[model samples]
Target: MAEEPAAPTGARSPSTRGTRRRGSARHRSYLRPEQPSGSPATSRAARRSARAGRRRRYAMEALAAFAGLLALVAFVGWWSEPARQEPPQPGGLPAVVGRPSLPGPVPTALAVPGLRPRERPPSPSPSAGPPSPAPVAVPTTLTVSQADIPDTVHLTETGRRDWMHWGLGGAGGTVRKRDGTGELRDLGGRGDRSGWDGNQELFRWRDGAPVKSVEATAEGVYVCGTGNGFQLAVAADGQPRTATVYLGVWMARGRLDLRSSDGGPSRTVRLEERHTSRSAQVTIRFQAPEGTRLLLSWTVEETFTPHCGNVGLQAVALR
Candidate 1:
């Protein structure tokens, strides 16, 4: 009766009809996905796609973290280390104090096998100096006489003439004969006797032939000839202030030169045509210094053809 009264005005009875509808709707909504349901294969494909997306997001996050770590390490390294600096060069001003100086690169020593060791340079000797000059042996007094002349003269007789051959003596003197027949001849105008003629001439022997005649003088076992030069070295007994040379000449037309080892000045005497006929004499005077050797030399130049003359050193006196 009460229910009949209540249902009288637009009120439905609480029945299972509305309950089933709401419950089914809620069940359908709960069971249905937001996206439409596809086939089984499509569903599996969608699930695989979701898994792949999740993996990609995780990979990106890991990569970002790794990049941040690398940045942090680089920053720390840059801050902890010192700034690089160039090394100072030599011959320049020194680096400022309290500033760190970079060390220079060390030089490497190279080693080679089978190589010889380097030789050390010779050290200078402290006691080394220029050597002293050698002392020259000077005679206290010396005399040159005809007896001191070496007996090395040669004479050969050939019927009408005689030949005199004399070599350069051991005193290191030279004799050169030119353009003459070097023979002692008898000057008897024409057809004269041979052995020791009072008038004899000297000739130059050249090419095994008698070429020209030379003037000669026979004086004291010595035959001095023209065009025959001689250099004689004589000793001095003492340091003489002056020297006088006596020359024995016949028909002289030559020159006499005097020199000394003491470096004294040289003197020359020339004989002209005035003393050409017979025996003549010449004197050469020169200053002689102490501790000096004397050298006497005679030279004859053939200015005129058949120039007849002979010269010899008779004596040399030093005082």
Candidate 2:
């Protein structure tokens, strides 16, 4: 090359340095990432604004879609609603409206094996009824009479209902019928009574109370003076019954009075023995209503002697 003019003292040597200029080059470092254009706080605010805008847009879109779905459901229901109908009147018969629903099946009773089937009886008519029961006839007859003393006086239980005997253990003691009906009662008397074993007629019994058994005995009780005697009663069951009272009089007139405790007919009989002891059996057959009593009262109507002439009682039997 034409001898290159001698390079100035400040120029590069030709072997290593080029006379033409080289293209410009630039280099970046991976160790440090590049930051955005603005300051750190400003860049973060811008990113947040962008994200919030996107989120709001998405939420609006979702809300709008939900509102549209509700509107669609309402519209569908309103348009497809069923029409109104009148209720079926109860008075309308099947011929007029046809049966709205089929009748329910009736229950049928089935016969059990080896068993008989019984049909219900028909109801009774109002116009007719079973014949009324015949009116019961009540026994209303009462009779009082005197009778002779038999040869043998059965003083025991004697297959009768009840019996009461006085003076069995002397006076001031009594014996009731054992296991009897408890229909006979001694109601006490108005006067003083005493024990006497002088009665001629014999008394015997095997069944009694307080005194279980007794042999032949002539013991009795007596009340002295006029208008003083003994009282007795037998319960009435609206049936006929008989009662025999063993009584006696010594030198006095004795009176036997009878009546129904509930108030009815009354009868009287008299026995007089002014000189000696006289005995008799009064048979009284009476009938009265239930809850009545056959009352017997023996009183000394008159006295033959001034010294304690009295009416005597031995025993009473019932049937």
Candidate 3:
């Protein structure tokens, strides 16, 4: 063909066509398989990895937006809420909700049963003088009667004879006597003396033993020995007169009688020996008119022996 395109310099000739074509065709096929496709031929594993990455990014962005919304809500609540206040303490002024305070002291009256409202007593007049003094009391005089004498008297016997001893032994025994001027003297062997000026005498029997007798002037008289008898006449003086007679006797066999000298009712007391050394006391009480006298008489009988018997008499007057 006009030298037909003069058969390009690098063109394959027909004679080597088979080998070159084969070689070149093999190379092109290998390179075509290695080149990227138009739409990528994704593998199953890579597609799954790409979808998971997109889901993770979306979750992160949504969480950040939720956190920002919570922060905004917290700020708005804090700015709108009211402030808090503390409660009042004890003994302090009470806090008022919406009111005023009460004033004044509390009243303390209580109702009582069966009691009327009390009225105050009237005050004394200003012109009234001081109250008069109360009157003093005077005690009245008291009079005693024979009934005041005690019904019982207690006494014990002293074995010694020094209290009063009568003259016995005929002439050598003790003699006790009171003269008209009230002077008493023991004139026998004993030589005793006293200044008692009253009429009294101690007598003795012919057998020399002292005999019992009434010594009218002595304050007290003692008698002893069995088969003895004596009488006493006592005078009373002063107005509203009363007298008490005391008789102390050995409780052997004896009888005692008391009667008014003017023949008033008589009272008698009797006793018999009991073989024991026991004593008795007798008290007599009676009213005696002024200038009157009382008669007391006693007798002792023979009973248990050593022939023991004893007695004493005393008279007292009250006005």
lDDT of 2 at 150: 64
Clashes of each: 13, 0, 8
Kindly provide the TM-score of model 3 when superposed on the true structure, using C-alpha atoms: 0.28
* TM-score, candidate number 1: 0.27
Cand. 1 Cα-lDDT:
0.42
Whole-model lDDT values for every prediction: 0.42, 0.80, 0.43
Per-candidate TM-score against the hidden true structure:
0.27, 0.58, 0.28
Worst 10 residues of 1 by lDDT: 185-194
| Local error of candidate 1 at residue 291 (angstroms) | 3.8
* Cα lDDT of model 3 by residue, 50-76, tens digit: 989989999999999999899768656
TM-score for candidate 2, residues paired by index: 0.58
lDDT of 2: 0.80
At residue 219, give the lDDT of candidate 1: 24
For model 2, residues 1-319, the per-residue Cα lDDT tens digits are: 5887787889777654442222111223434577667889788999999999999999999999999899778656754555334465578833333223332376344444554533334545567678899767665667777776665566774428999888876798788778988888899998988998898888777787878777777888999998999999989888888888989999999999998977778889999998999999988888888888988899999998999999999888888
1-319, model 1: which lDDT tens digit per residue? 3554444566555776698889999999999867557778789999999999999999999999999899778656644565455456588966443344333377233323444323334544578678999755543332222222212211221211212222122122212223223221111111111112222223222222232322332322113345565555444434333333334345556566656667656656565443442222333333343435566665553334344345443222222
